[model samples]
Target chain A: MAGGGAAASALSTPWRSLLQRALDGNAHLKHSTFFQLATVGGGGRPANRTVVFRGFQEQSDKIQINTDARSNKIGEIRNCSFGEICWYFTDTWEQFRISGFIDVVDGSNPEPVKLQLRERAWFGSSVKSRLQYLGPCPGLPIPDDDLIKDAHLDPSAGPVDAFCLLVLDPEKFSYRNANAIPWMLSWPSILVCYVNVKAGGAGLLEINYGQAMNAAFKRWLVEVNRKTGPPPQVANGRLHIA
Target chain B: MAGGGAAASALSTPWRSLLQRALDGNAHLKHSTFFQLATVGGGGRPANRTVVFRGFQEQSDKIQINTDARSNKIGEIRNCSFGEICWYFTDTWEQFRISGFIDVVDGSNPEPVKLQLRERAWFGSSVKSRLQYLGPCPGLPIPDDDLIKDAHLDPSAGPVDAFCLLVLDPEKFSYRNANAIPWMLSWPSILVCYVNVKAGGAGLLEINYGQAMNAAFKRWLVEVNRKTGPPPQVANGRLHIA
Candidate 1:
């Protein structure tokens, strides 16, 4: 297991732990988080849309979002194979900007890992959500409100073909205070990390402190694994919590 | 002015008018409005950030957003020359996805029109907003909370060199019902339009209706001016209301 995000001498509680706790769960996580999925479209013009955050896997160093297979974003993801998701839990006064190259899992990739992920994602889906793909392509014209409301599918038949898991393998994480002062003033956050994608490899970490916007912390290629407490050492095979 | 987007027969009220009313002044515009500024970085990865809706120009088919000169977004816009802004005002239950190319005006462009727009934007900016540029480059590390809180400029000195006007020249508009149901179902909104950049020129318009997601309204090269009203025809030059 790669292990490098050490606690800085400045703050009593490490910022990584603060982030981990936020990701672990809270009361207001659902409302505040927005997934930023930007794709390079024609003429290299980027198309960005906000989607609901389905899940985040700290162990795999991946963030998860769901999308309809028929949606424009799926095409964009396939074309670019990279994107970013910005999450702000204003309740916690913290924001995270994650840039990751995407690794998708859908009905096509029927491996055990994919199956486990899809099954887990399916368990979380509501009948209303499962029916999102039953209608025509998104960003297209619809007949009327009544027609749109009536465009539901039979749930007994199980999830449709459009259900997809977009797991973002994060390479960089930018943590910042979501207040009017420091954030607006461009004062850097206390912590930032650049994770190397290589399995069991080290990552770059930077921490800042002191009074006058000083450069207090910067580290290169620290050993980093999935978690802080006793690395699970899942290097041999991938496993997840059900 | 090209006037092809005549009020459609399907809906009792046209979608354009509905949108115009919402933008005219409503309690709900602030939360849902986010400008989608996409710029292709050196690696071709597009950078996207949400900016406040400074204002919207119905007469000249332009939308307004303010940004700092030192911010990364301004650099991206100058590189791309075009971007998109997605606005979802849930209170009115209307979502607008506007596609526009870019035209920026700062103190550098001292034309009367530019000066007027800049002055109007300046009036809307708060002291806190004006102070955003005094800090270091955004997305950079900061030393501490005190450093951030102390990083404000003297109010009497006024706005800094970082303040710039971002006027988006709109080419397309997609307005949809903001209810989670149909919008998630990818059902198209009631009104969509394509505005030609040329003044007093015809633009394409498309409206949808019927029971089965039908395309009932389509107008090619219809006269399209800023307002969907009887043409005052400002074809010779770009004119806007104060």
Candidate 2:
């Protein structure tokens, strides 16, 4: 019911809550829910495509997405399972860049676990969605970058082999809130500067999915929220530091 | 001006024309001109972020871009130079996916060519854009993703070491037009598939920068257009094959 938290939980609580809303997809219409996905292509280059938001898995570790099976992105995923997705909600300038190892869940997989995933994915594939797969494979020399023919398969029959549900198993996350950035690791924060400098030399520090610090961040958030209600500023997506 | 034309003159003219529009950044509003850029991260996962549509350079293979030198993306570019960009116009459903080797030009470079490029990039940057570079480097976990302290640098005083100009040296392109897909590589077009299939199997087919086939494609588009004006259904974003 509350939005943000007290001094100590300032960072973690609001951050988690916002992401949860983004994952939910339908709850809010104020900001864009679409996310841009990035994957390494066969030529070892990074390739990107736009995908609408799908619900996050129960544990919040894996994300689900649907795409045309014949798209070039599928081919890139085939080469490397690693991926990153960037979500930018222009309304509040709130952006989340999540990186993960990706897996394609399609009907072809025979494993029981994979089959279960495929079944769930298949349920989302409407007759219209399935038609995209049956048409000409994308990336072909079509006049425009879309399937030439719209194959309307009977909904009762269900999706064909080309219907693909992509799952992103998150490994890292970069959260940026441009609107309410108050805490700065300035010259006074020598320790932070040292850490940032070290990370800088290595290029960038990736937030590992299972880091002890992340657990600390969650624990800290829970402890702070146990007593205090969400702060006022969070309603507008502001992140106030202690 | 005719839209597309001649296999003999095909590759260069049409290829040049399409890119000129993509590069123009201001000419047409018929479709969404925004492009999504994907770059491989130091951690081996793909990361995508947005950059505004800046004008393209004429008679040059390299496409121009300006970014904060402190941003994680600039650092990512330092590590791996490969990338892919996807553009979609909501109105026409016209999209282009271009892949290329990436490069960044900054104050750090002493080479004549790079320095020249940086100087040109500096002239185009507005004062507001330059301030982003002087502030905290992006991705630093300081309660927000952007710099908390907005450090405004004097425009007359010139840029800090953080202003960077990036260029993408495109190596491949995937053009898809859902509006008028007259050429379907259907079962009948198996021979055409054989050629494209061969190209596909080898993985991403990087355009040789100046390819004869690409030139021919543009020419073929022109030839097709002379007989056919904007097909009736292109406005609704429909894919129809003849």
For candidate 2, lDDT tens digit of each residue in B1-242? 11112211332332344444433433354223346788887767687876654445434545667776767687788788877887654433345667787788778887987877777667666766555565444322333223234454556764467677778876766554333343211222111111112211111112223333344344544444454454442324322221
Per residue, candidate 2 scores C-alpha lDDT tens digits across A1-242 of 11111211323333344465443433354225456788987757787766755555444446677776766688888888888887765544446777778888777876778767666666654544455566444333333323233344566664467667788876666555444422211122111111122211111122223333333334433333333444433323333222
Grade the docking of candidate 2: acceptable
Best by DockQ: 2
The stretch of ten residues in a row with the least summed lDDT in candidate 1 chain A is A217-226
Count steric clashes of candidate 1: 13
Query: Per-residue CA lDDT of candidate 1, range B21-120, in tens?
Result: 4554344334444444555554777665556666554345566778766665776777887776655443443456566687777777769778677766
Model 1: CA > 4 A from native: A1-30, A88-94, A110-112, A138-158, A178-180, A183-242, B1-17, B20-36, B90-94, B110-112, B137-159, B178-242
Q: At residue B176, what lDDT does model 1 achieve?
A: 51
lDDT (Cα, tens digit) per residue for candidate 1, span A204-227: 222232123333222111111212
Q: Estimate the overall C-alpha local distance difference test score of candidate 2.
A: 0.52
- Model 2 ranges off by over 4 Å: A1-16, A20-33, A58-61, A138-152, A177-180, A183-242, B1-16, B19-34, B90-92, B139-152, B177-242
